[model samples]
Structures are given as C-alpha cells and as structure tokens.
Target chain A: MTNKLAKLIFYLGTLISLVLFLALTFDTHRQIQTLTHADQLSEQVVAGKRVWHKYNCNDCHTILGFGSYYGPDMTKVYWRRGSEGIKAVIRSPEKFTTWRKMPRLPLTDKELEDLVAFLQWTSEIDTQGWPPQDQKLRGAPGRAVTLGVSPGAVLFQEKGCFACHRLYGTGGQQGPELTHVGSRLSYETIEKVLTDPRSTNPQATMPPPMVSHEERDRLAAFLAGMK
Target chain B: MLLAYSSQRVAYPYFLVALLLFLLQVVVGTWLALSYAVTMPQWLVDILPFSTTRAIHTNLLVLWLLLGFMGTTYFMIPEETEREIFSPLLAYLQLTLLVGTGVTAIVGFLLGWTKGKPLLEIPFPLDYLVVAGALIFLFNVGMTVIQAKQWTLIQGSLFGGLVFLAVMYLFNLPFYANLSIDWYYWWWVIHLWVEGAWELVAAALTAWILIKITNVPRELVEKWLYVELGLFLFTGIAGTGHHYYWLGAPKYWLWVGGFFSALEPLPILLMVLDAWHYIRNRRAGLNGRLIFTLAVGMSILHFVGAGFWGFAHTLPQINYYTHGSQVTVAHGHLAFFGAYVLLNIMSFYYAMPRLEGLAEFDERRGTLAFWWMSITMMLMTLAFSVAGVLQTYVERVMGLGYMTAQAQMRFWFAILVVLGLSLLGGVILTVVDLLTLRPALAGAKKA
Candidate 1:
C-alpha cells in the first residue's frame, strides 16, 4: 500500500479503536459499582487496602488475579480461610510453616482487622467464577457415590475439612484424628462439636464451622459411622 | 568519532548507566529464581524478603529500559533533525533525576517503604521525580524538533511515541479506593505502554536502523513503519481488554479481549517478514554485521515471544486458568526480553562503534554473547512454561493446595535457576565484550 494510504489507515484505525475502548470503559465504570458491591466499601476496607500496599502484599500474593504469583491468589481466600484464619496467618506468617515462607510483618491488631475486612470485601466481588473450584472437590460427590459414603463425605472435602482433620491419614495434623471418632463420641456430641468447638473446649482454636443445622447433623452422622 | 552533532555524546552516559542497571537486574533476577528453587534461611528472609527483592528486580527493568529509550532518542534526534540537541544540561539532569530516583526507590523497598502496586511501586514521593524527568526529556526533544522545523516520519513516530508514553504515566498517578478501578487504569499504563507506545517507538527505531544497515529507500522503510504501527494500535488499544477479563470488569471484555488480542500478532508477523525481506535483498557490502544480526534476531523473537507466546494465552478460555499462574510468568520473561530488552541492546550495538570513531570492529565476541544470551533466555522461558502448565494442571485443575503443588514444581524451578545463572553469564560476557571492544589494527577509522 502507498504511504498515504497507510497513514490514513493508521490514523483512522487508532482513533476508532481508542474511541471504542473509551466507550467500553465508560460502560464498565457504570456497571462496576453494583458488580463490586461498592456500597460495601467501608472505611476499614479502604484502610485495609492501604495496609496491603504498605506491606507490599501484591508483590507476593495476587488479588483480583493481578500481581505476582509467588503466593496463592487471595481473591477467594476469605471464603477459604475465614476472617480468623486470615488474621492468624497475617499476625504471624512465620508461624504457619509451608513450602514457601511469608515474611513476618509487625501489624497492629487494627491493621489485621482492616486487612481481613478488605479481603472479605474482595471475596464478595463478582469475578465471574474465577479461581475455579478444584476438579477434585467438584468431583467429590461423585466419588462419594462410588465409595458408598454419605453426602457428608463430599461435604467434608468441600468444606476444606482435610486442611485440619484427618480420617484416613490423608489430612492435616492441626486437629485431632477422626478415624475412630464413632467409638469415642456419640452423634449428639459430634454435632455439638461441629456447631461450636468453643463449647467443647473454651481454648479451642478452630472457628465454629459455618454449617447449617442439617449439615451439622449429616457431618456428625458421617463421623459417627467411622467405627 | 564522526558525530554529525557534538550533542549526540549525551547518549553515551545514558547507555553506560543502562548497561550497569541491566547487569544488576540479571543478578537480582537470578537471586529471585534461586529463592523459588530452594528455601531461604530465616536471616536472609528477614533482611531481604521475596517481595522486596521482586520489587527491586522489576523496578530495575523499567528504569534501565527507560534509560535505553532516552539514550536512543538523544542519539537519533540530532541526526534526524540535522541539529544539535536543545540542551545537553537538561538531558544530563534528567538522567540524574531518573537514576537517583531509581537508587532511592531500591533502597526504600529494602527499608519496607512502598506504594505497593506491582510494577508502579516507587514510593509516592519519588514518583514525582520520575514525572519531572520525563517532562524534561519531552521538552528537550520537542524543542530540538521545533527549532529544526524539519521532520521525517521516523522522527515524528519517535516523538509521538515518547509523548504518548509520558501522558500515559498520568494514569498511574491516581489512587483509587476500589481495586478493580485501580487495575483498570493500571493496565492503561502497563498494557498500553508496551503494546501501544513502545511498539511505535520500536517500529520507528527498527525502520531507522534498517535504513542505515540495508541502504533501503527511506520512503519504503517509512511506509512499512506506518503500516506496522497502524496495525499495532488498531489491535492493541482494544486488546487491553485481555487484562480486564478476570479483574472484575464487565463480561463483554471476554469477547473484546480475546478477539482483539488474537489479532495483535499480525503486525509482529509483518515485522518479521519486513526485516527478512530487507536483509535478504540488501546491498552487497554489509556493515555492522553484529547490529544487523541483532536487529533481525530481535524481530524474530519479538514475533515468537510477544506475538506467538502471548497469543497462546490471550484468549479468555485459556487465560481463565493461566491468568495468575506461571504461564503469565513464562510469557512475561520472553516478551520483555525479546521486545524491549533486545531492542535496547540492539541500539547499543548499532551506535557504540560509530560513537568510538571506528568504521569496523570484530563481531566475534559480540556474536557469541548474542547467541549465548538468546539461547539461555529461550531455555529459561521453556522451563517456566513447563512449570506453569504443570502448576495449572496439578493446582488449578486437580484442586491441590498451593504449597503442595509448589513442592511438585521445585524441579522446574531448579532448572530455571540453572538457566538464569547461564543467562547471567551471557550478560557478563556481553558487558565485558561491549566495554572492552576496540578497533582492530586493520580496521578503518571513521572520518
């Protein structure tokens, strides 16, 4: 093509694409408030964001799928770890031993609270189903059927029970083993433990599981049958 | 040296500082790769955390690349406009401000001071210095072009790209309480600078160098430059959508990002073909063999790393899984090295001999450095790609925990550390070769 034609194409194409992008940007701004639940953006969450930046968290962990990949994506972390778990980790990252170590930051209690609030707010944003559910967890119900176990077996996986409790020597060691819990405790006691670990032991570090009354019954029954 | 204008010497210090920073970046990058490969002791973690080191690594890349670009502009504009620079004092001052700010920022990061957005992590106070430096550069170049009252398309493209680059930095200055809003404009600076403004500058520089080495007609080279940059902006502006896909943006971005970014490779392909055609049919006597080879090599890798590798994941379907994984890391290393890093190094190779008053010099050491760096970089990219795919499968797909999956990927990280060390060796060889190069006994001196 001639130089003039190329120049014309360059100008026209750039102008058109830029204009379209601006238009989309405008529309995005309009829709983002509702999509991100902007009304829930509290002063504390905003402070939490500053805390995040001040500590250079994004350099390690990604939020909204932007930033470095050294740590786990924190987009859905609130749902996975809960407020207390997140605070505990941040309070003393060095204490939580893992394959990679998180630097211990000296954060005030208020900063920890704000950071959790920020993460909780992020968890509520509509990411169009990002951080896709793990295939193993998604397939747990089917595997439960294959194993002839109660639906609670699938619930155990979905609820991240394996992170703290072991049944067949496949889970974490922070919590007591439930392999023969049926012989040690009845279904009623098991249900109470699921509902309120603090009730069983005031010093319990486990946050109360966020299950419904029915889910607690099923989980208790599933554990009671372990014998 | 037979410089057309004495002021072109301003580029010399810029090139020197850029090379120093480039070497530093590689060293820090190697340390980072090693961190992933092996666990660090508590004392080291306390002193230099991964986050701090990572910030330094990336910030150094930006600082050095910008210096290279500025140095290149200083070298080219006086020749293009047929006049001396507007003010060498301002140019040197700009460099000092930039390098000073870079040093302070690195030190600050170690001291736990940061604004903490990924690439734009210079503390809030230092950012103003960066802006001031940019403005000074723009003013210096702008005045030089205006005083001459004569401009070529290549000169126009370079100046326009520089202006676009400076204006784009404004988007990075604002603070948005909402993260989605923050990232939305953040991509404006990060994405647009690379694909949009930087491409324009690359196209202009590539065109200028092609004309110098191949003795091609200026009109023909400028024509392709126009077409290349035209195609670049057409696809790249809308291609910013790709970054928006999982960042809590509107849903339509999926289609917009996927479709537009898929077309982004077309211009890079044209660039590869254009460079190939010009090199093949050039005049019988070839000068600056190292420069020619680097230029051609840069084009090919630009296509492979930025174009092909980027296309592999630009589509939302695949990126949905790969967005924050090592897949992005794989693409990032290659794309930056192939496009910007190689381009800057090519400028160094092209200008250094001429600046030293030599008509010709031995290309053997330079050629070896090129191949060593290139091969090791590609291998490093391959290692990251393997690690990325495995991480995605085991972690994202299989639902394994992050630490668990990372444990499995340690072998690949080990490989990356080895490749990085090799790459650093190449960089050292390059620095040694470039710094030690001299005219041979039989080499002709420039008039």
Candidate 2:
C-alpha cells in the first residue's frame, strides 16, 4: 500500500473513533443527569461526595470496593453503623481504637451529615447485589445469614440489637450478650419476651415487638438459630 | 561518549534519568510486593502504607516515562528532520526543569503532600511546573522543525502526539465538583495518554528505529507507521468508554467501552507483525545486537502484555468481575513495562551507538537482562492474573468474605515477591550495563 493511502486510512479510522467518542460523551452525560432525577440522591448527597473527595477518604477507605483496604467499606456503613453510629465514629474515630482504627476527620457537623448522606446514596446504587452479604456478616461469625434473604436479620440490626446485644458475646453491658440465645430462649419464650417483654424479665428495657405476626416469627426464627 | 551531532547528546540525560527512576520504582515496587506477602507491622505501615507505595510507584513511572519521551523525541527529531537542535541550551534547561520538578513531587509524596489520585498524584504547585516544562519542550521542538529544510511523517506524528499530551494535562487542572465528572476527566487523561498519545509516539519511535537498524525502506516503514497510528487513534480515543462502565455513568458505555477497547489490541498486533518482518528480513549486522534485540523484544512483548492481556478484561462482563482485582494489577504491570518502559529503553539502546559512535555494546548483559527481566515480569503477570481470578471467584462469586479471599490470594502474593526480586536483579544488571560499557575502537556497522 502507498504511504498516502495509509495516511488516509489512518485519518479515516481516527475520524470514526472521534465521532464515536463525541456521541458517547454526550450520551453518557445525558444518562448520568437522568440517573440523578430518578436516583434517590439529593443535592446534599452529592455535596457529601465532594466532602469525601476533599479529604480524599479513598486514600484509606473504599467505597464500592475501589479504594484502599485499610479502612472498612463504607458502602453499607449506613446499615452497619446506622445514622447515629456513623456520626459518632467519624466525629471521633479515635473512640473506636480497639481494632482496625480509623483516623478522626476535622469535619464540621454539616460536613459529617453530607458524608453520611453520600455514603447512603452509594449504598442505594444497584450494585447488582454486591458485597455478597458475607461482608455484612462481619458482626457475627458462622451465622451465614444473608440479610436480603432473611429480612429478620435486617430487623435484628435495624432494631438496635448491635448497639447493646452482642451476637458472639461482644457487645454492651446494658443488655445480656445474646450469642447463644438459641440455647437460652425457646421460640415461645423469645416471642413472649418481644410481645410481653416483662414476662422474660421484670426490669426489661426492651420494647415489645411492634412488627406484624409474620415478621415477629421471622425474627424469632433468626434469633432461635443462634445455637 | 563521542558526539556525532549536538542533538544526539540530548538523549543521554533522559535515558540515564529513566534508569534512576526505574531503579527507584523496582525498589519501592518490591517493598510493596513483600508487604502484601507478609503481615507488615502497623507502626511501620503507619509511616509508609500500601497506598503510599502504589502512589509513589505509579507517579515515578509517569515522570520518568514522560522525561524519556521528551528526550527520545529530541534525539529522533533532529535526525529525522536532518537538522541540528534549535537551541542546545533550551534542551538542557528543559531536562533540568522537568527532572527537578519530578524529583520534588516524588519527595513531597513521602511527606504526605499529595492530591491522592493514583497516576495523577502530582500536587497542585508541582503541576504548574510540569506544564511549563512541557510547553518549553514543545516550543523547542516546534522551533527545530520550523527552521528545518525538511521533515517527515515520523517527526510530524511525534510532535502531534506531544502536543496532545500537553493539551490533555490541561483537563486535569480543573477540580470537578461532581465525583462522576471527576472520574470522567480522570479517564480522559489516563486513557488518552496510554491508548491515545503514547500510541502515536510509540509508532513513530518504532518506525524510526526500524528504518535505522533494519533493511526496511523508509517509505515502507512510514506507510505501516500511518496504519498503526490510525489504529491507535480509533481504538484509543473510544477506549475511554471502558472506564465509564462502572463509574456510575450511563448504561450505553457498556457497549461503547467494551467494543472499542476490544479493538485496542489491533495496533499492537500490527506492531508485532511489523517487527517480525523486520527481524526476519533485516541486514545480518543489525539482527543480533542489544539495541536491535530490544527493539524487537519490546515490540512483541508489548503486544502480548498490553494488547492480549488488556483485551482479556476490556469487556464489561469480565471487568465487572475483575475491576479492582489483582487481575487489573496484573495487566497494569505487564502493560506499563512492555509499552512505556521497554519503549524508552529501546530508544536509548538504538540511539547511543549511532550518535555517540560507541562500539562493542553489552550484548551478553543485555541478553541476560532481557531473559531475567522479561521472564520474571511475565511470571509476575501470570501470578497476579491467578491471584486476581481467585480473588474475584471467592469474593464475588462464592460470596466469601474479603479476608478469606485475601487469604487465598496470599500464596500468589508470595510467588510474586520471589519473582519481583528476580525482576529487580535483572533491572540492576541492565542499569549497570548501561552505566558502564566498554566501547570498542571502531564504530558499529551500518545497516
């Protein structure tokens, strides 16, 4: 082939590629803008992403499994820590100095709010059901509980058992550690404790289970299998 | 070093600086590999962590390769244009500014002053210095061509590529408020550099080397050069879509990124074919030496690593499994070493003999170094590939925990540590050979 024709072919290929790039660039921008409309994230959430970038939190932590492995994954921290725990941990990470510490950030309360909102938004993205739920099993060992499959497991944390009740004997002194509650409480007794909590203990600070009968049964089954 | 022309001496500083940076990268890189293999102490890790190690390694590679390209262009430009350098003083000043700024940035990273983006880690102040240096280089080269009575395809493409490189850096200066937008431009810089501009530079450099060292006619090499450049432009520009697949971008990127990136391997394949032909039908004198051998080795090795291995994961389906896995690391190691590192080394090897009138090049050390470095790197790539595949399967597929998945990858990391040390040994040998070689009384034979 002649040199001129080769140059022409080169230009042709580049032009085609350029045309694709221009079209894709526009399409991608439009798609992302559209996502924001249907997406649950508010303006505050995106500003929270900016706060995450400002500190370059990714230097130590990962979101969606793309950053350093030093810090815990923040994707499900909203679910893991809840709104209160996330605020407490980042407000003073030095407080949780027992295992795998995170450094404290000098964020204002507003910044903290934004960062949490951003993390919450990230968790909502359809990660095609990533993190495989085993990551959420971080609290208890050998439970093999898939939270999505067993809504009761989600209820366990959402009800704030993690704040006071330890699954493997590693929680607060406010409540009895429930690691082997299966051995300790039968389904009838466990249900009675939730429905008529004073029957199990007169000094019980636990609220009665307010969920539907089926949900109560599921949570009972989840707590019963502890043994 | 006996000088033939003023422009020829310019490559020495670049090749030597690249040698130093290469040595640094290997040392830090090996330390990083060992850290992964064993449990590093927290206190020590507190001072120098894995993230810092990676940041330093990638940044140094970027710096030295940039310097190498600038230096190689200086050497090739004058020869290709058949003219002297526009201003020797400007050339030296450009090198000093770039190297000084680059070294400062690396040192600053040690002190924890960085922007924290991998590969785009040059801090705010140093970024400006880099821009100035690139502009100076462009001005000097642009002037050299302006004054020349003649110019060729190689010179034009190289200048065009350098201009693109400098212009691309401009996008990186803006701080996008949106994380998605930040990711969008970040890929523009990284993707465009490796797949876009560097392709042009590599093709031109390959053409220049083939014309000088082999019996290939200038016109034939230039023609193939255009074809390669054409492929690079097509696959490279559109290839940025591959990065958008997971960055929370629109859904159409899955098709755009995957299809174009799959085609990215074609240019490298063309390069391999061209080199094979050059080696097979070349003049006997140019067939066996260190410089010619590197030219051939790097060309084919680049295709194998960057082309073949890159295509392996460019598909969205596969990338979903391997996005941040060690499989990505595997491709990173092989692709960067083969495409940029070896490309610079090839420029050094072929340029010195012709320009400095050196004889008796380090054939033995070069060959031994080739075997050690190339073989060890390939092994490391294989190791990372295995580790990555396992990590993906266990972590993503089986729904195993991260620690459990990492535990399985430990065995591969151990293999990588051993292979990394071996690669370092070969690198040291190459550095020593380049630094101290005995030049024979007579000059190298012409092709």
Candidate 3:
C-alpha cells in the first residue's frame, strides 16, 4: 500500500478499535445497572449482595465482567454449574475436586439460600456468549489440574507475592515464613484455610481467598513441593 | 587534592535525612502491601484511617522523590545553566518549608483533617504551601536558565516539567465542592503529574546524566529529548482515559486511554535503544564506568519495566477489570518506582559526587547501592506484577469478595515479604555505603 493509503488504513483501524472498545465498556456499564437494581431482585438476591460486599466479593470474582476474575465469572455461574451442582459445591467444594478446592464458607442457611438465588439470578442474564472459550476445565472435562508450572510461577511474579513469601528460600519477610507450607498443608487444607482462614485461625490476618481453585491449586502445589 | 571549582560538596546531612524518610516510607508501603495480602477491616469500614495510610505512602513517595529530584536539580541546573544558584538561602528555606508542611499535612490527614480526595487528600489550606514551594523552585531554576541564556536541553526539560506541574496542580484545586471534585482532580495531579510531566523530567535527567558521564554528543541527546517530550505529551494527555474507565466518566475514555497508553511505551523504547547505542559508542572514551552503566541501565528500565508493562493495561477493556486491583498496583509500582524513582537515583549517582567534588569517591559503594536498589526493585516489580495479575484473577474473576481474594492473595504477599526484606537489605547497604564512602571520599581530589 502507498504510504498515504497505509496511513489512512491505520487511522481507520484505530477508529474502529476505539469504537469497539467503547461499545464493550458501555455493555459492561449496562450489565452493572442490571446487576444493581434491587426492585427486580429477590430478597435472597439482595441479601447475597450484602454478603458479597460485606466480604468484599469483588476481591475474588468478577460479576458482569467488572469485578475480579480469579475463579470463574460468577455472573452466569448458576446456569453453567446448574443450581443443584452449585449448591453441592457450596456445601462441600472439596468434594468437587481432590486437587482443586474452595473454602467452605460458614454461611447461614438463609445466607446460603440467598447466595444461591443471587447466583441463579446472575446466571440468567444475557452475557452475549461470554466465556469466549471455557477456562474452567480448560475447554476439556475432568482434568485434575494443579498449578500450570511457569504460568503459575509467572502469576507469582505478577502478583507481587514474591515481594514477601519465599518459596525454596527466596522472596520477602512480612508474612508467615512460607518456606515450607506446601509440604505442611494438603491442597484441601490449603483451600480450606485460604477461603476463610479466620475460621481456621481466629488471629490469622491473611487476606480472604482472592484466587480461583485452579490458581490456588497451582500456587499451592508450587509452594507445597518447595523442599 | 582540592581542584578550583565553583561547586561545593552537597552536605551529607541532606542525604542522611532523605535516607531516613525513604526507610520510613518503605516500611509503610510494606505494611500496606500486607494489608492487601489479607482482608479489609470489618468494623472501621470508614475510609479515614486506611485512606490516611494510603495518602501517607503516596505523599511520602512524592516528597522523597521530589527531595531527591530537587537536590539533583539544584546541583544540575546551576551546572547546566552555567551560573550559581539565584538564592541558596531560599532553596534551604523552601526545603525546610516543604518537609515541615508535608509532614504536618500527612499528620493532619491521619487525624481526620483531610479533604478526603484519593490523591488530592491534603486539606485545602496546606496546598498553598506546596504551591509556594513549587513556585520557589521554578523561580530558582527559571532565573538561572534565563541568566545563563545557554539553555541546554536538560534545563529546558526540567523547566518544562516544573511549569506543567504548577499549571496542572492549580487546575486540580476545586475551591467550591464539598467533596472538592476529589476523584476528578485527583487524576489531574496523579495521572498528569506522575505519568505526564514526570516522564519529561525523568527523560531530561536521564539524558543529562548520560551526556555528562559519557560526554555523548549533545545533538543526539537533544534529539532524544524532543522525541521523549513528544511521546510524553501525546500519551500523557490521552492516557487520562485509563483513570476515567471506572470513575463514572465518558465511555469514549476507553478508546482514548488504551490507544494512548499503548503508545506510551514508544518513547521509553527509543530511550532504551538510544542509551544502549550511546553507551556502545562511548564505552572506551568514558572514564567513570559505573555512572555510565547506571545511567544506561536506568534508560533500559524506563522502557522494559515501565513502558512494556504499562502498555499491558493501557486499554480501557483491560483496565475495566484491572482498575483498583493488584494489576493497577503492578503498573504503578513499576512505572512510578521503576522508571521514575530509579531514574532519579541514577541522577544522584551521576551528579551528587561530581557536584560535591568527590569524583574519586568510593565507586564501589555507589555500585553496590546501584545493584541493590535495582535488583530489589526489579524483584519487587516482578512480584507485584505477578501478584497483581493473580490477585485480579482471585478477586475480580473468581467471584470472591475483596477480603476473600486477599486471603488467597496471601501467597503473593509472601513474595512481597521477600522483596520487602530484599529492599530492607538494600536500604541498609545503601546507608552503610553512603556513610562509609562519605568519610573515605572526604579526602578525594575534586575534578
């Protein structure tokens, strides 16, 4: 292409990208509005919202693609997992996978019911076919995944965790000397503690479980075998 | 061994004070990171105390960086301007006022005396003092440049940075709002000053240090200077889109923010390549190899650590998920500390001993400080970035609440602890080296 034509094409491309990005952002905004309106939501769903914020749910999960993206997009979670499967997982996340685990949070029955309603409500929304590809099970079924090695390592690096905890005698000093925790704790125990460590230890001050089962398992095993 | 020269040795006391403050700031930042590693407080859900810690960490970073920058600028402007300072007395007074006022403001913030803006959290009254200090600095550097009439690119660059900073700061102050347009103007200063004007200042200092140490051609340095400035202006202004992504602002910001931020790395890339090229050409001619190496290394970091990683989150789409998460922290950690503060430290290594007539000072100590600082920060940046991305996954994508996400993120915090300790080791070594080298270099010949 001639320089002028190439320049024109580049500008056109830039303009198109800009337009598309704005459209996506607007869609996100719309989703947020839909998520926030309480009149249409059930009391259980409202109570679940309270639980989400009280625990700072945005710390781990993205709803409508706007919060966190650690475990799964919980927006359509109920539909994906199905209500019965989700309730079962909620009852005992450890039973779902031997390798992957989530903290069994101590939610009251009402809270659990509300949380289920919230998840169900979330799953019913029009997500414009998100999940572009299935991240869970990595587009395959029944893979007992631990942490993927280097990506997990890269995740460790990217998260600034290396600033504090040492794996195999490397990193920072402000937290529990995690030089040997992997061998100390099973993936189940690790998942249990990570989800809500206050239940495990009242004085434990570690932040709430902020990662997904896969990431947790990946990081857990990485640290677990650190001898 | 005293050679006749106009410059006097910068008092060791200034560095001593700067070091102590830096140590304190690092401790706070470490604590803040720990807070992130765990959960937010349940009871004191008030933004007051946590906000104070945030302000303190951010403000101290700005102050110390400024102190170091100003000290370097004071030494550099005179040399580049070819004149003595217009008023050394005023410079001292300005320093005292800034340190005093800054400490008071932070104290006030902790005591619930803030306007409650995220970055512009300092109460309205104290801002006047900051402006006063900035103006005095501008006058000192500005008059020196004018008097010399031999305005080099470095001087032009610093002057440009200072001028823009003043204008932006003034524009950010909202005199009327109860909340004072807290978040809006916060970006004016935070987004504009740090990413916008600071790049100009950092590039200017980096190029000047390279020129002085390597005695590289001024023409080449000046050309790089313009390219840096152009890139800074283009990306810096447009980069405001990143901040607007979540602030209930215009949707068009995503496009503007992403595209501009993506381009933000260009100047840094150019800077890194040019520095390498300059060093490769001048290595045989350069005498003080350590300073040359530090200056060049600083440039490369400006690109890879700051520029490349910054581009990773420049898009509003990415930022939509990443905003206020560990990912943002990752970018901020690298860009602010890696590119900007590291570059300032490079300036100090290049100019401090020379301006102080301690050219033969223990290059070993300086070299150690250089490596310790670089390695510690590099590791820290890598950790923060990794932690941030992981944190994003746990917190944003995973459907875990903030507290829950933080619990999982403790793994990353473990890494931060390691980096913190490394930084601690580095800081201690820096202090020791600075102390030992001072007395040792006391008797060295002035060039």
Lowest lDDT block of 10, candidate 1 chain A: A133-142
Candidates 2 and 3, the one with greater lDDT: 2
lDDT of 1 at B431: 81
Per-residue lDDT value at B310 in model 1: 98
For candidate 3, give the lDDT: 0.61
Tens-place lDDT digits, model 1, residues B170-262: 899888999889999999999999999999898888888788788878888888888888899999999999998877889999999999999
The models' CA-based lDDT, in order, is 0.86, 0.75, 0.61
Query: What proportion of the true contacts does each candidate reproduce?
Result: 0.67, 0.37, 0.00
| B101-215: candidate 2 lDDT, tens digit per residue | 8888878777666776657778788899899999999999999898985778888888889898889898888776555666688878888988988878888887887877786
Q: How do the residues A1-227 of candidate 3 rate in per-residue lDDT, one tens digit apiece? A: 24444335434544554465456556645554443342356666756655554333443354544433334455555534444445555665444322223445556767777777776655544332333321331211111123333245544543335333544433433346565676677767766775677767887644443467787777666555544
Which portions of model 1 show Cα errors greater than 4 Å?
Answer: A134-227, B441-447
lDDT for model 2, on a 0 to 1 scale? 0.75
- For candidate 1, write residues A1-227 as lDDT tens digits: 88789899889889888998999999999999998999999999999999999999999998888998888888877655557567767766665655577887889999998998899899888887787742223343355446665768766765556556766654545678877888999988888888888887888766566578888888888888878
Q: By descending DockQ, how would the candidates be arranged? A: 1, 2, 3
Q: TM-score for all predictions?
A: 0.90, 0.83, 0.65
Task: Tell me the docking grade of candidate 1.
Answer: medium
Instruction: Write down the worst ten-residue block by lDDT for model 3 chain B.
Output: B175-184
Residue B199, model 2: lDDT of 79
